[model samples]
Target chain A: MSLIQFFNVTKQYPPNITALDDVSVKIDKGEFVFLVGPSGAGKTTFIRLLFREEVPNRGQIIIGGRSISRLKRKEVPLLRRNIGIVFQDFRLLPDRTVFENVAFALRVVETHPREIKPRVEKALAQVGLSNRARMFPHQLSGGEQQRAAIARAIVNNPGILVADEPTGNLDPATSGDIMKLLEEINRLGTTVIMATHAWDIVNSMRKRVIALQHGRLVRDDREGGYGYEA
Target chain B: MKLRTAGYFFRQAALSLWRNVWMSLAAAASVAISMFLLGAFLLLVFNVNHIANNLQSNVEIAAFLQVDVPRQVSLHIQDQVRALPGVTEVTLVPKEEGLQQLSQQFGSEQDLLAATGGVNPLPDYLRVRVADPQSIQSVAEAIKAIPGVEKVNYGQEVVERLFAVVRWLRWLGVGIIAMLGLGALSLIVLTIRLAVYSRRREINIMKYVGATDWFIRWPFFLEGLWLGLFGSGVAALAVYLGYRLVLNMVGPAAVFVPLIRDQGLLLWSTLGLVAGGSLVGALGSLFSIRRFLKV
Candidate 1:
């Protein structure tokens, strides 16, 4: 079985709004994939289902040999622990320093105090944010804040990294820098899946791209380009 | 959980509590206000009950004898009264002594009695004490049925009225305390709910980062605990000081009417209030945070 599989999945909201309809896909370990679509294209729903944030309405989702479509409420956290999530707004705690923000991920899981510092330092270094550890989120630039958020996500060394428009708030140059960091993390054998509307980055990386249109999977390309215009 | 984990929760709780200092204070103040009222009512109830018990225990049935009843008959009646069920003791007051006591109550009005031709219209009576105040009416009725007894009086109207007042006061105290307690509980819940709502974005981030539900809960729980502790602590102090002040201010004037002055009782009651405050605060916080955890 593939590492992450969605078999004939359908998700619907109230009053007849179908987010993902009868979609089936498989993603293996150590594979970088991009989820490409316009707004309301079910890309966010797909990511939500991957993390068990929302369960499918009519199918099975398997992650790491476990069927998560009907996973227990208590076990949802366990599933999420193996996955790292990034958002467009860079959801770092405003009151905490960058180092504290990264360490927060470990602290919640009751990691020892002695190990929190070094692991946070290493994650910050991975994002090239070693010197900005003492700064707060507001004190950092837009790119730096995203970098801090990325550092927090990867600090747990999760097997899967999912980013939803991580570069949506940054300039083109900074977006490229963020993409390079994600690629480096992927090269380290962590499966990276990013959702984006950045055509240039999509065409340049040429990684696996899965396109969704109106809740249906339209194409799965091993080396896809920005087939649609911005 | 590790000590380090506990320390982390405590630090986080402290930080958030400081961040929302105004809201936290408001919740704590509500708890304090409710607890203070509760403590005051409790003290009132305890003291009133104590005074009532004292008065009831001292109730004595006075069985007045028939006019011209022989002394031998009066002595026999006293013996019979002492033998009756629940009768603790009986003492006879001769007609001469009754007249003497009445004159003494008149207090230096000897000339008035002299003007009445030296005639004493007083009757001999038996003072009857019972084991239980609750049985005073029944015992009085029994004594009235005895031969040679003209009437039985235990100050029936006065005693009944006093007991009614005590009962009413007790019920009123309970009702007021209950209403205040509910008000405090909801206020704390509302304040904590607002606190939770304000921090919901932070909570969502925590959830996305794989933090367990309990992990997100601990800090908030600790915050509630502190609010309860501080609020109730202040309330307990206020109640204690207020009681002490009242006692000192009214102690000498209320010498004839017994008031509760046991330091140990006051201390225990204040401590109980503090405990209740803390529990309410903690449970309120936990309840308020439940829906927000769905994220």
Candidate 2:
């Protein structure tokens, strides 16, 4: 059964700009999907809509068998708790240590204090950053910073992980390691939807691919390779 | 909320304040200045009202009897004036005693009254005190209607002017205080807005991580509360000290001038100012964070 479904969703910005137009797709639970497209191909818009950050102008988006398009303002936070999000910039509190950064997610959710320490330690260990927990974001390398961000994202044990250009700023070797980490996370029965422009990484992964161009889904293939060249 | 969560909020609030120590101090200082000015004006207005009340209470109508009226008829006129509504007391001042009092008041100029050539020109009068100063005019009119009373003089023009001035000053004081209050409120809002602006990235991250609006709001609220508390608390201390100093300096010199020497009243007012400042600070922070919460 599909864990996520988009039924003819449309999104438009102000002054006659269509960011995403009439896109539809579905991905089942435990699937790892790569969103491959150019810079203005509505990939970010798609992730934003999935997270309920932006509402579709038309049609419905169903995640875990529920329509999120009409979710109330107060219920938005609850909806967001079920999905972990990662970004290219690796947004972390500069003044906080890696351990505190991961624990921040649980702290904000008002989780039991005793549960937060173990959960954060587990997440940091998963990202292979258990020993780097004492370092601040500014003191960490770009790859280490991204690893900490990933740890923060997964600390709450979200069912769905949506990453937008998670390895966009890393070297090829570092990006490869990050991809392995994500694949490991996906292997644990969590759905992972990643948007990236790294063609080489996409081709090697042999994951399900969804391509978009000019706000329209042009192609989707099961176990597809990167079609576009560097 | 649980105690642990409350503790977390306070810790976060204190941490953020410490991180932005300079900004926090600037905001607190602004609040202190505004509160201090408000406190000073309040004291001034209170003392002015006190002195005005003292002056009004001492106001009495002096009804000079007709020169030909006998002592028995003068006494009867005094009783009639005293029987009027709002008239609290009436005392007769015989003409000889009035002349003697005038001579004493004249002091080194006593010989000026010698121009009367041993003839007492001053008329015997009834000193009429009223229950309410507001009713002094009506009571004086009632005294004028009694037989054998020559003229009822209560310095009506000067007294009315004084009352009008007092009323105007009271309104002016209120207007100034309201403006100062607004000034303090906006200053707090601006400072908190800056605090929110500096933490915009943290706020965005919190939103994405499913943090409730209130969870994000609590720290800013506490920050504003601290700013207001410290600012007004300092102002209250300054106001108390300044009032004490003023009382000491003025007490011995102006013994007859009724200053507001009530310690309890000042204490209550300063405490009230601190509480009001804190409320304003909290509200200001809430207002500042509203725009940022949209994320």
Candidate 3:
């Protein structure tokens, strides 16, 4: 069964400006999907809609058979809890240490204190940042900071992880490393849907690729590479 | 069973509190100053109201008797005064008794009174009180018309003036305190907003991470509560201690009638201040979050 189904989704900002128009797609459970397009290709909007950050103007988004548009406002949080989100800017709390930043995800979900520590440590270890758990965000390198953010995103044991431009800030070497880490996370039974505009990573990986252009889904291909021609 | 959740809520509250210690302190201090000003103004209004009530209840129309008036005639006039309209009570004081009362009133100046040397110059009079304070003038006139009554000295003009002054004062105190309370609310709210803005990134992150709006809102609520709780506590202590110092200093001098005669009332007032402080803090935090910290 499909874990995520977007049915004719349309998102408009203002004055007839459409971000995502009548986009329909299905992502199966445990799938590794890459969302690729230019800067204004509605990739952020797609990720945001999955998390129910903003409601689509006209369409239904189904996750695990639950309809996003049909869900009440109060139910959005529970839906969000099952989905992990990482961002380009890292979004780490400046004051919190790496450990605390990861643990905050568990804390927000009211995870037991005893359960929180082990879960956070495991997430840190998964992201290869176990040793730097005590360091603040600013003290870490850009790659390390993104790792901490990934740890934070997955600490709550989300079934699906959505990363929006997670490698947008890192160098090519570091970006490849982050990509491997995400692939490892995907291998461990968590579905990974990453949004990026990087041609090299997407081309080299040749994963299931979904392409968007001018708010429309241009391509949905298996083992696809980057670029409009491909 | 719910202790774990409670623990998390408070733990988060404390963590965030310490994270922005300076802003928290400023928010707390602003609340404290607001609560203090409100409390002090409250104390003033209460004491003034108390004094005014005492003076008003004690106000009377005094009708002096002529020199060597017959006891039977004075008794008859007393009975007639009692029958007068709006007269609540009429108590007759003999010359000797009246003189004694005067001597007691001038407690420190008893030596000066003793220099009069048994002359018994004080006049016998009937003290008349009216049921309605506003009708004192008519009551005084009626008392003066009674046969064998020499002169009427109700201090009606003075008492009316005092009532007017006291009424004006009550309103003025209320107006000032109300304005000050609003000032405190706005100031604390502004400070809390600053605190909220400082944590805007944290809030955005929380929302993105699937935190319920309440989960995002609770720590801020707790922060505000702590600010109010601590602020009010400080204000109550300051005002109470300050009041005690003033009372102790001025009480011995006997320069004026004691304003706050009831010490127990201060305890109640302190409790009120604490409650108000908490309210202000919580409300300030709520307003700040609602206005500035969008979940």
Candidate 4:
């Protein structure tokens, strides 16, 4: 089933500059896709639009058969709760422990207090950081911090996980480990859309690649590699 | 919000208070000390005003009639005294009644007062109470201007000194207390502002975590409320104990002090101070959070 649809989407920043111009695409449920391009190619804008962080100028984006732009401002939090998001910099609260950080997502969405403990434990186990549950963010290495962030993002069992450069700051070995985890998560039926500039990783992944240039969709290929783009 | 949610927010407020213990203590202390001083000042002013009212009504003028004045003339003089401004009450003292009152005052010397025999020699007089002690002099002079009145006496110099001192003390007490109250209010606001500012990072994190703005804000609001209620409690206790100590210190010289004797008014006013303190603390916290800083 098509879980995400962008029909004739366009986004323009102020002063006559366009971020995403008439870009249209569709992704099936549980699909793992790669978004690739050089800087200013609307890769960030594309992910931001999917999360409804930035609205398109002229478009309709349907996620789970609901129009996003028409949603009221108060409903934005409800929308975001169902969609997990991971960042490049691993934005974790420094004061909270690993378990607290993972549990925070469910707690905020008003999950039952009795259910928070087991859910957080399961998320930490999924991230292979169960032993580090009591550690603060400053105590974790770069890769572990990203894993903890992933645990927080997926703790609510969201149907969609949108990652903006999840492996951008890690070493090559750590990046491979994080990609393997993402693949494992995708196999569990959560659609994953990742934007990255890592040519080697994209080449090895051989997933659906959507490439953009100057706010225009230049290529959408299945089993596509990084070499398909300029 | 559910009770569970409210419980969580209250826990968060307590955690934040503990996290910034020094700032919280400073803010609370400022509120307590300010309220204590204000309570003390209010109590002092109330007692002083009470004493001043007592002193003002104590002195009254007496207009005496000449020996040869007819009974009709003395009645006319009594009516004239009653019509004068500031005259509160006027009672006519007939010659015989005045002689009888003189004998009572003379006590063991009744023989000396009754030596005049049945032909009473005391002058008929109009005993007067002026509304204000300060206006006694003017009212006495106006009484002396009456046609049948021979002399007027209301203890001029003593009343003048007393009225002057009470008015000066009241003015000074108000001025000093007002300045101190303003200073304390500003200090409390600054301390609370610092407290809220240091927590802006936590607020920003809450916003990013898909928590509604109100859900994140409620904890901080509760923290402010808790601090205010606690600080006012402390101030009330301090003021209450301090007032007891003051009463003890002034007991020997209480005649001059004339502290308020009614215990009920004292307690109601103390409760008012506590209420006022809590409100100021709560409002200061709100102002600092909403206006001084934004997350």
Pick the TM-score winner: 1
What is candidate 1's DockQ?
Answer: 0.56
Q: How high is the lDDT of residue B31 in model 4?
A: 68
Prediction 1 TM-score vs. true: 0.83
Candidate 3 chain A TM-score vs. reference chain A: 0.98
For each candidate in turn, the TM-score is 0.83, 0.82, 0.76, 0.69
In terms of DockQ, which candidate is stronger, 1 or 3? Answer: 1
DockQ of each: 0.56, 0.63, 0.47, 0.26
Q: Candidate 1, residues B121-193: lDDT per residue as tens digits?
A: 7778999999988888888899999989998888677778778887898899889888987887887778777
Full candidate order by TM-score, most accurate first: 1, 2, 3, 4
A1-230: candidate 1 lDDT, tens digit per residue: 67899999999999999999999999999998999988999999999999888888899999999999767887888888889999999989998899989998988887888899999999999999999999999999999999999999999999999999999999999999999999999999899999998878999999999998899988898989867532
Query: Model 4: residues >4 Å from true position, as ranges?
Result: A1-77, A94-96, A108-110, A134-139, A183-230, B1-7, B59-88, B93-202, B287-295
The CAPRI category of model 1 is: medium
What pairs collide in candidate 4? none
Second chain TM-score for model 4: 0.73
Better of 1 and 4 by TM-score: 1
Shift in Å, residue B15, candidate 2 = 2.8
- Select the stronger candidate by TM-score from 3 and 4: 3
Better of 3 and 4 by lDDT: 3
Error of 1 at B274 (Å): 1.2
Write one digit per residue (lDDT tens) for candidate 3, span B151-213: 998666666776777688778777876776676677667756766777788777777778787
